[model samples]
Target chain A: MTLEASFGTSKIGADNIGVNCGTMLYNEVKQFRINHSIAEGKIKMENQVTLKLNYPLNEYVAQNELKLQFSEGTTLGDLFLKEGIPSDSVGFAVLNDTMLHLNYRLQNGDFIRVFPLVNGG
Target chain B: MKWYYGKLLRVNLAEKSYTVDEIPEELFTNYLGGRGLGSYLLLEHVQADIDPLSEENKVIFTNGFTTGTSMFGSSRYAVFSKSPQTGLFGEATSGGKVAPALHSTGYDAIILEGASAAPVYLEINDREVIFHSAEHLWGKETYETEDTVLREVNTPKAQAVVIGPAGENLVSFACIENNYWHSAGRSGIGAVLGSKKVKALVFYGESKTSVVNPELLQELMKEMAATGKDHAGVKAYRRLGTTQMVAAMNAAKAFPNRYWRDAYYSHWEKISGETLLENFEVKPTACPKCFISCSKKTTVKTGRHKGLTIEGPEYETIFVFGGLCLIPELDEIIYLNDLCDRLGMDTITAGNLIGLVMEAGQLGRIPVKLEYGDVEGAAQLLRDIADRRGVGQVLARGIKEAAKEWGLEDLAIHVKGMEPAGYDPRPLKGMGLAYATSSRGACHLRASFYKPELSGMIDRKTTQGKAEMLIDWENRLTIFNTGTLCQFFRDLLEWPNVERLVYAITGLEYHKDKLSEIANQIVTNTRIFNAREGATKQEDTLPPRFFKEPVNNGQDRITVEELQFMVDEYYKLRGWDDSGYPVHEEG
Candidate 1:
């Protein structure tokens, strides 16, 4: 899971894969063109990993997603602490397809989906 | 009983008349309300050996002290009867806007007894019951019937609980529709109503349940509001609804895919909650007097089935149709969900029966041929089941009859003739015990032990101490039902809150031990009823496939040894003998 996404302009959404690169997707991504957003003066971040915050968390981040460049070997807990997210507030997290705990180390170019606790039937 | 009207409305369909009886304070004192109260009333009024669909069978509707109050999840109701589906103790609960209305009709509970000579509906206002001819509405779907009744009653703020064609046909899994979308959705309660020739019941009133300590209630409300505003559960539910389980369960590899042939679906992303929000025009819908709008009113905006809308395809519906039957498209699942709602059928049971048929067709065990993911074919079969045509006729009798008829008894996954919800109990070993010993046929909600297992609250594969935890959760949830509160508020409504709420509402404080005692007693009462109907250890076991098949090609499958360990422990802990019967309890 090394970083492979390019600085392209295609927007990713839903379950659709990002066409700009071969392996990057931020489903529910409104405008996640990393370099393109930076070039357009939308955001200034050096991180390669994207965190798509679902609800309440988005309020804390002031937006739907955050681009954080994590230190090598950084765990999910490290990233959440850096981003000011309370670990207890998080119900569950998914990195791509697998459910990963907070102790799981972050992979480069990872698209993490974090949501609060939902009472499932 | 300052908080309660302490009244029972008994309607005799045979005579088209009603009577309001003074309910004993001692009854409420012992059983609380909702499930406990209703079950006691059921046992007292109806014989255990009577056919569930016969006129002698009684349908009891109940609400708690919190209902019609300022409680957050108060707009929920419970229906208790002998199940036409399982031929055992039957109970179904739902959250909607109906409970408050029904509660306001100035009674703690209502009982419908005897069968009418023709199709009829009842109009219930404050202290009055009006019988009406429902002959014209006998065949209408639940939504249309509700709308017509609401209009015909023409009373301000009136609500109707109605049944559809499936109920009229006495489909064993038919459910009573409420809020036009939500259902007291399991146990064939609608079939009970239909057998009594009752098409619908209307409720309306301004009467309210008095609070024992209004100031204390307000204080608790203030504290709750302050803390719940930022609660993760609230944010999550308001955002994604229960459909989020599709992602969590799928990601954990705990999902049941392709009628248990697989553990996870390849096309899961297409039907996940995120995908549904991403693809469909989903609007969050809430019941009356609630803030967490967890129900998704989704509409197809782009496909050929565009503009089609339904209140949900909840996690259970998605798991059954999308996971089991392999309906890949979310919109198609929504379509089938709408179909079940309109027909007044329980989606879980309907999808399960259809999935069984699909498995049968795939194996060439039946004359009909339908494949997995064949949306049209499944839809046709669903219609057939509701209409009681050919194979549908057999299925309308229930899974027990259908599986026996198709000679696929080994393949059919059920307990006590009722199918399970989304989770595959084989892998979640605790769920195995849950399904086997639920008293109401393979019910998930009795404990919803999947929540603990899937969320890592306990070891998923271990049976050690599982019975202890399962009983804890089940007893607490029984209190939840006795409160008539929605299960979504389980996180927010902690035991302390429950204590205070009960104190404020009933002028009685329910400590954990006291609550557990009441819950255990209530469950044991239901067990006694089941035992009287000939239930035994055999009925309290999982299906054979669970013991043999491993899910997802993994080693997470359950063994009869493991399930028996938990069952024995559960029974022992409940003070029951090795036979799974209560030792010292009275029926």
Candidate 2:
């Protein structure tokens, strides 16, 4: 099991991801994984990963950076949880320009995008 | 005569008479507009200890000085009365095109008095006012009533405030539906209108609200539209709507779960905003001149509740009807919102009462069976309640009375007979205190803490100075409502723009210090009006649940003692004796 992550200009690790899931979200996601058995596969992280963010709607990927590893069969919500962002904050998740669900499993070469419900119109 | 028409529309329902009365210049200067006007008028007119739903009660609708102008997000209005829910001073506001319409109709506010002998609707178009027969439209739903009125008047874009079957049946929590979807949703003012036999009120005016300083106004608007994009909360609201708060609050352990017995829900992902977009229809709607359009025009696509249409199953309704009741189904919640919309009911009150019913059922106090997540049962029961049929009659009396009738008074979750909003106070300790001591009672919008909780508008867990924070928010919000600006405008306007915008419109140049004084004056007058209505420090206290029982989870259990200390600190900050009432210093 391996994972990678990046946020902003900083890079943390290529083997593990960090998420500070609040008690409410923790209980729910914990129960969800247990019921679905999604964790039985080879998708565990050994070190923290880095996810970059910018203003507006940009994802954390570059053409050459696609082979960085740590993104095998992971869900958008799981990625957000790994990064300490709440699941609700990710209003819409996109992978390769297509809208993906929190339950959408990630592939190795996929670029992930997350948008929050910032404010109402 | 720039922004304000500087006049009040006075309607005596008993006599079926209406007139335009000039407002005093001194009144506008001291009180400002909208909420400020409501406070001054309430102090001058309404008495304490009267039945809140009686003819003696007065319902005043007021717009701010900038209401009808070109100022962005300046089209909100306030409704003031002695709340039937809290039995204290109540102020509920809404964002729509109506406030500016009132201003264009040559009035700053409309004050309605006495009960009508029969159901009637009032129409105001500039100088002309007419009371028409609403007998044919009395039984219509809120949206239907507005549609009928729009067709009759032949005005495609007119706005209205109308009630539903819930109001007709005197459901204490029923709201006055505005702009079809917006609502003055708290304190059961709809029941007051029902008691008066009034059906709806419509206003239409094409005249522009003038600005004293055009250049300054233009600069302010430009500044607002620019900086507004920087606000994180505004951005989230724009993208995800209020539904985004569900995930954030759930993560922060602030979302109330299972009738406040828990802080977290295990099925949150299924009901989260991300999931809602995946499962339901989400469209965008906005108030007049507002860029932050948070309202989601929703349509249920599946299940027995298919084709249900509603403006929002906002975070509050979603939490209350969905998570609070253990029903994580998004479509069920959307249908419930539509039901409440058609019934002209307040989701806050309805959700609270339904939670009470679930609590009662859990305790085996009521013979009738009910359970959390019973969406169909809840819907049927809601229908019964709105029509005052059987158990519905008991439920329509509100949580306090229903609890009393069932002989399980302690099961009711309320403060001063008002139900708490979407957030569970036990987990978010400061919010519990905020709800208990709210001037209107158990309302969260009085000063929502999610900004502080999630985004760092203030500190979340720090109760040490949260009281001062609450006061600051309430005071600033008072000025916001008085200025007739939308809450979203805070993203763009800030305090400086508030002063600049007002000065530009009214031609009254007041220093920043004078603006603070005006804000404080509005607060003091509102407090004094409550005092006249017999509201005291003791009325400001949390429900028995938060104080008596310890809401426990994996970690961070909260008890009554912790909440008590916060309440004490809050009262101290509010300048009240231990009780949380406004303390008057003798001159």
Candidate 3:
């Protein structure tokens, strides 16, 4: 789904503060090129993955769900950086409904869910 | 004497008289203040067998020794009474301007006794106490009552704690709202206030507390702020408030859903903190002097509930209303939250009751056709309960009594008459034990064992070592609650800091060990009080659901045999007898 459709772009624009989704897209493009070159010899093909970002965290991505292509060994941490999610903002992550570390390698057809940092009673 | 105001205000509404009594220095040394002192006073004044809604049942509002001082997260006060719902020791703490206002009134505690002949409010301005007729304010919502009280008292800066119509109508889970949003919102403390015919407490004071070591306090406050800002938990709380837990808890399969029938909510993301910030949150708010602003001011900008501004549908509210009731719409959750606040009812109990009613209807146990996901019906029921109308009358009694009356005791999800918070204990063993043994019944805050469990400080799936960990947590929280500090600062405030703060404020030397001893003493005393009220080992238990039902898609389950083992281990750790009574050491 398009970012606008998933996040309701109007509501996002009104609430978006320090987050710049446009810049994040540009950075992701740049990083993808670099990773593609680095993995050219190591891996044969790109891995398609589905990512879901839960709220507050979604503010950074401006989309609830994203389908992206990544290098075979690309870590969730790399995806977070490419998506403009500050390391400090992430509380935990789930991969295919299981808790995973940021270093977890992205697999083809894998689904990852990102949660924002929070604490309460 | 430096930190403490060294006085308590005693008001007998029946006689319409007020008196200022000097606080014994020994009381501070023994009980510290806030929850500890309040518990002591409850045992002393309130009879164990007295009906909680009777005039004989005393309600004590107390600030900690460090409360109103320059200590970080010290802006809290405790409201202790015999719980109209649980019939046990009931205490709820709230943050905002009220504790500081109470502290500035030159009293460490304010004890209200005897029912007023009519609705009345007590106004405390420094040394003076004025009893004002509250006939006009009685049935108003909490926010409106606070505004009216402040206007009538003619003190713009004064803080007021008022109850809404639910309390006046004697809804068993009624809460006392302060500063419009903050509430001592558990254990039916508001009903106790209602029983005494108290409409509001308006406090205004300019009196400043004397600090024994001002320089040390200043240094400590700075250090605390600096450390708190760098703390990970504090940062998370500031950014996402408690809403952060929605995704994480759901992922961990610990978040309660559908009245504990499920551990996961598929629509959790739609009702999470992120969603709230995106759709409704206007700004972040905090209690007085708190570095971490975990509270939110939210407003609906569009749709049917447009322009509805409320302080929060905090983590608990979201869990209860959103997850428990299957209400996926954030606007509906926010509206219901506002309704509960305006009606002056505990959202946890209110939502739990609705969930119970819905479950009962599904089982054909009740004639009502209420169903899960019926947000409008739930909101109507909240209002009805506040007004004590029809089915609402039965529900207004809370889940325990209502379920008992319906003869559906097994379906009521509560411990000691008080409903559990969001966490499903079936997945978290320590929380199960904590809920079962909590003095106030099914409370998470009394000992937030979920933190340790979820954070991997201990095994969440195992009962091994949980009993000892629970004992430690209970003692630690006893100190924190008695210190009257916000639990949000648990990571920042340590034992040494507590001791140093106490020494700096009170000029009384207290080691970490001494504080632990005091905490143990207070906990033991509370147990004794419960024992006197006929609580036994049996009462210290989770409901049948935890034992009989499995959570996490049936991946995890707690057995009755396992819970009994934990209870036995906990009682032994507490030095309680087999019957769960505290063992006294003879000199």
Best by TM-score: 1
B303-379 in candidate 1: lDDT tens per residue? 87899988888999999999999988998998899899999999999999888888878888888788889999888
By lDDT, who's the top model here?
A: 1
Candidates arranged by TM-score, highest first: 1, 3, 2
* Candidate 1 docking quality: incorrect, acceptable, medium or high: acceptable
lDDT string, candidate 2, B1-587, tens digits: 45666778889999988888888888888877887888788767777789888999998988887787777777777888877766778788877667766666667778899989889988877867788889998888889997887778776546778899888778888888877778888888888888888889888877666789989999877876776655545666666688876765665565677887776677888888778778777887887787877778887787777777778878888888887788888888888888888899888888878877786788788887789889889999899988999999988888778878888766677877788877777656667767876767787766665444444444444567777777666666677778767776664555677778778888888756677667667767766766766777666667776666655443444456666677788666655665555664321
Interface RMSD of 2: 8.7
Q: Write the per-residue lDDT of candidate 3 for residues B130-229, one digit (tens) a residue.
A: 9999998888999899888888889766889999999999888999998777889999999989989999998878877777887888888889888775
Query: Chain A TM-score of each model, in the order shown?
Result: 0.59, 0.44, 0.61
Query: What class would a CAPRI assessor give candidate 3's docking?
Result: acceptable
Considering DockQ, which of the candidate structures 1 and 2 is the better prediction for this target?
A: 1
Q: Against the true two-chain complex, what DockQ does each candidate achieve?
A: 0.33, 0.11, 0.25
DockQ for candidate 2: 0.11
Q: After superposition, how far is residue B286 of candidate 3 from its true place, in Å?
A: 1.5
lDDT of the structure predicted as candidate 2: 0.71
Q: Candidate 2: which stretches are off by over 4 Å?
A: A1-121, B510-513, B552-554, B557-561, B577-579, B583-587
Local error of candidate 1 at B563, Å?
1.0
**How many residue pairs collide in each prediction?**
1, 31, 2
